[model samples]
Target: MEIQENAALLLIDVQKGFEDEEFWGRRDNPAAEENITALLDRWQETGRPVVYIRHDSVVAGSPLRPGQPGNDFKELVEERRGKGTGPELLVTKTVNSGFYGEPDLDTWLRGAGIGQLVLAGIQTNMCNETTARMGGNLGYDVVYALDAMHTFDLTGPFGWTATAEELTRATAVSLHGGQFARVVTTAEVLAGASAS
Candidate 1:
């Protein structure tokens, strides 16, 4: 916590595509939207820089395909957007990492003099994790909001299917209290940012 003046909030892929029941629905962390909303409110109140990243899937007919309704932020998240206060920047990328080719999130952060990033949003083990890793590698101190990220149950080639909850927890354990990032609750983040 305790965001520096040069700190910015990076909200990754809180899109309607993920929130839609027909799409990649059923997340492990249902509270992610609420947590992200709380953080957004606090960031708005403090006038801290808030950056929103939207993922544009390159695959045709993907839920996040450009110009689709699902590409927009979900209802809960949409409530946080406007001209007055909330997010200061909205960057769209086709890759899992926001720093990838696209709107140049890394360059924007650097231009804003941001050395610290508070990250939150969907798919804890994917987009969120990738962004956090990239941020850490790029020399930014990252703080991941534990309750503000989520993922879906995943089954791959290992004959093992991990629930979203398990993936989220494991990702947090690996990121928090480590060199990558500090994982903290929304309360801790709010208090720290406020105090800062």
Candidate 2:
């Protein structure tokens, strides 16, 4: 895997709200935060651009809603803010796709001359996946860091439930091989960075 020197690391919806197992069922990828933190550190160290997306849920009582403690970024991610030499951008969005966020992610990326994106964060099949698809469609090289993302179990309309691990695997299958993004492990991405 080749990661461009200027590729922006998009950390989507890595907030404390995702830690609420009571609100969001059991989740897969227990080490997701550690992986994300590692990638963030490397990107900052190498001076690669970084973007953080926060989901501000519109649902009246959602954990991610404004004024909720869950809306804040996790401590590890928050600690690295403004520590990187590369530019940092924060995008707040109510929708699943980070591209639709305020200040306009696409516009910001375009203005910054970024044409490649590396994605990681919460909800493997939700915000992260949606953002990857959008980034691909918009002609950016999108890399999906599978191991750096975690997702909760989901229940369908028919009441059939899917395990978080199953959903995460499905997300990887659907996004890999030029569909929406290139799905790779966190180590793979970090190695690519180191190689570059």
Using TM-score, give the best candidate's number.
Answer: 2
| Model 2 lDDT tens row, 1-196 | 7888989999999899988889997998889988999999999999999999999999987899989999999999999999998999999999999999997999999998998899999989889989998998999999999999999989988779899998888888888854888999899999899735
Clashing pairs in 2: none
lDDT of 2 at 80: 95
* Candidate 2 off by > 4 Å: none
List candidate 1 segments past 4 Å from native.
83-87
lDDT of 1 at 46: 76
TM-score of each: 0.92, 0.97
